[model samples]
Target: MRNVAICGSHVKNFISSPSFVTAIEMDGVPIFCGLIHTEDIKFDRHIPENRFKVLVRKIAFSYNYRDKNLIFTTAIKAALNRFYVVGSEFVGEVIDIGSDVTDFQIGDKVIGNNHYPNSGIEGVPGGLPSNNSSTEYQVFHQIKLIKVPPQIPDEVAATISIGGQTTYSMLRKLSLTEGSNVLVTSANSNTSLFAINALNKHKVNIYATTTSMRFEKELKEMGVKRLIQIEPNSENWVADELAEEIVKEKGSFDCIIDPFFDIHIGKLIPLLASGGRYITCGFYDQYSSLIGKEFQYRGLTTSEIFVTMMLKNIQIIGNCIGKTEDLQNAIQDYASGSLNVVIDSVFSGKQVGEFFERTYNAKDRFGKVVYRYD
Candidate 1:
């Protein structure tokens, strides 16, 4: 069987330019990378009872910051590492099922876990996906799978499993209501876009930050009135200049939704209103871009953080993936045409290398970038 997988034990060295494993051929046919190493992976024919093979045909998986951090940020110097398939979500059809499986049939369009909960990033290192989802087929547990509504687009269905759930869970915790003021960073992110869509009905005043004005039109459509644009590389960025600008323009935010957790935390904490919540999913930048280093955002002295927290009476919340309930809600909203999933672009299987490249440098992507299988 052909599979495109991450090399856990082997790291590819890019001399002039970085490289990625985007293609693979099954059996004797050189589908992706030239072959002849069947000994590496013993294709097991013995099927597990609760596990099943899903021919997602086209896999729509998002690259998490944590994964890139390990691979690129520190130049792949993670203290503890292992070999396993890499991906967070999978969208496709179940072509085969186990003996005891009754929830799925031979051809059920579905969505499910690509790996153990939050393992694609920081949930746990050991629980990587059994099948790297970039392949044509995957073996996923029945319990982790959900049936996609006929109304949901394949691309939209593909994007939901991770970003959707995260947004749903975060919004529920923030408890936005009319007259509430909220702040979100990386407004163009899939997670933030979904949160903004959900908050649209709440009539909450939304404040968003973007590095580029290209997303200005998109943010406005999501009901964001005030947009904050900052340069992490700028000398004044870490000086809390953006924080002060936020106060003057929007005063204080009731909730701050931040997935890109880095040195900006110190700047953001002061911008929160009394009893406000600061929520985060991961520190994506520290791992992905080795470019201009931002000032110390995290790792503040205990006294410095404690004083800020006490002064504002702010609550710091760490959120990983959302609960099953969150996925269900997101799915329902998508099916009902209430949720809007902005797909940045679609790439073909032949463009696998370019797909990863686009994701690495997401230029002008307002939503999820989908890779559709033919």
Candidate 2:
């Protein structure tokens, strides 16, 4: 059988575990290099189910210590170390299969939904659908292989996999009934726009913020009741009167969809109703560690989100897309024209450095920038 090949580019080398087994040699000698031997992974169906799950655990990462320091200002730099390691999330096709492997065969195109929770940048990683670190062909578990849907384009599917799944998980936490007043921050974003598209069927009153007049106009055309464009440096906009005006006009948002973390928890804490919920899921100039710690320290309105859960009957939730079912549903919605993929721009893999440079530095672009894999 001819082994499939895959490759990707990154700014740094990926480091591998020292104890991983080796089954192949390069230039007549074994070496820990870019290539991994498929023979190293032996699938044993005879093993007990507990042992199988344990083997799965062996393939996963356990980095759960909540150090507030790991969060960085840049996404690519935060992932610099992970670029070398080949794990189950690094998708590889099955060139040959054992008789017991009933689910896979040769020539099958597949991707691994890394089944490890919070292994990627931020706390967004979850099993099987959360991370998209699959930039190359490497050894992957058959259990992790999810066939690409026939109707969906691979690039769009890849783009939606993480963001779509995260939104789906958030929706599970919410009961977005009709007539719910919702204030959606970063309404011009890829995930935020998708969230708004998802909420379109409900009788929810929509209020959104954008920095671009063009995007605000586009969102207003999509049915947002009111769209506010705030300058990034506008200090006058964050004062008490503006918040009060928002409260009076919107009748206090029953739920806020904040993909952008710009509105500090303290800043918007008063805008939520007594039993309301605030959901944040986007990457701001800072990461969750900074926001999480600052909100905990400020004793400001954020205290209600973190502490009032036990005392004030309110809820604050963080959202990220996570679930094959949700992805499947989202695909259907996209096919039927209910959900949309707002691609701001596309960059080739070689141009990804420039892409990340702009994404991290530019403060104006509203849609997602994606790389088309060759």
Candidate 3:
């Protein structure tokens, strides 16, 4: 059996292991000898499918920052038992089916997502793929997999599972309409980008926040009227210039889609309209170095923040991955060309670490960063 694993130390090694990936040369194959352990991996031809394997040849898989951080978490280290598969999104075709399986046939393309339990977004506990998409082959339950329309390419279809669903769910939560004044943080993120593009026809007045000007031209093309640039290290995320511009132009945002809730949330409360909505699909500040910091409140420390939130008559909604039906509808949108999934780059097999690293250093990519398998 063949599979790819994102290696990390066992909880037992957490005390002594100084590093995660300690590669040692052996027979020209690097074996992780420290916190992580990598061994020779080979695939099987008797790919027995108890009725569920995506594609005969996995076409592609995209990178999500959560996948990398998940494997590094102390909880994940212990919960995953020994090792962790590194991807939550998978795109491929049905090459095999188990004896009683009747939902699929050979060559039917499909997309699947990893289940996030206990997430703020609240979705059915439909099981996730048994392993991450970093492997050449993965066997997931039939219920979690959604068949993709033939028109959607493998790369674009790959995103419908996670990014698309998350965006769709957040958009619907915002209840956006024509002339809705909205603000989206991390405008270059795949989730944020998809959400913005999906709102194109709604005639919404879009304001975006980012630290980079690299995507300024593109985001403006996407209809973002004003952009707020915030540094990760800056305490004043909503700079004075942006605040003045907002006061001069739009009084308050009717909706704010934020992922950096840990850092910039203090600035958002004052910007929300009387009955505006503040929804977060994720919090990046909480994703600290797993081996470095303990899991605690990395975002908001003051109860006053919540008090202000409530006093403003604002709604604070927490989101994770979307519902199963949301995933299906996202695929339909991608298939019908009602949505677009932008991919930054593609990698090939055996580049697991490379894939994670590229996504980690994504300062210039506008959309998704993906990898393919032959």
Highest-scoring model, lDDT: 3
- Provide the clashing-pair count of each candidate structure: 3, 11, 5
TM-score for all predictions? Answer: 0.77, 0.63, 0.79
Alpha-carbon deviation at 214 in model 2, angstroms: 5.1
Give one digit per residue, the lDDT tens place, for model 3 in 1-374.
23445443342355232224433332222333222333434423245544332333356777675664554552334442355556677788776666555667778888775444522223334435533665656555566677788898887876668787787778877888889899998888777888777777578999998888878888898788887787656556557876687788978889999876765676666778888999987766444554455433323446877787778888989887776666766777766777767777776545545655556654565677777764
Best by TM-score: 3
Q: Per-residue alpha-carbon lDDT of model 2 for 32-74, expressed as tens digits?
A: 2122223343444455432211111111111111111121322
- Model 2, runs deviating above 4 Å: 1-134, 211-214, 230-245, 260-263, 282-312, 319-321
lDDT scores in order: 0.62, 0.50, 0.66
Please provide, for model 1 over 1-374, each residue's C-alpha lDDT reduced to its tens digit, 9 standing for 90 to 100. Answer: 33334443233322112234433322121222211111222223245533333333434555444444433422233322222334456677766666666677767788764222443333233233333455556665565677888898787777787777788888877777788888888787767887788777678888887777787877897689878787766655533765666667767888889887774575667777888888887665453234444435444466776688889898988877676677788888878877778777777655665555555565765677766665
In candidate 3, stretches whose alpha carbon ends up further than 4 angstroms from where it belongs are 7-57, 71-84, 113-124, 286-301, 349-353
Model 1 steric clash pairs: 58-373, 69-287, 263-297
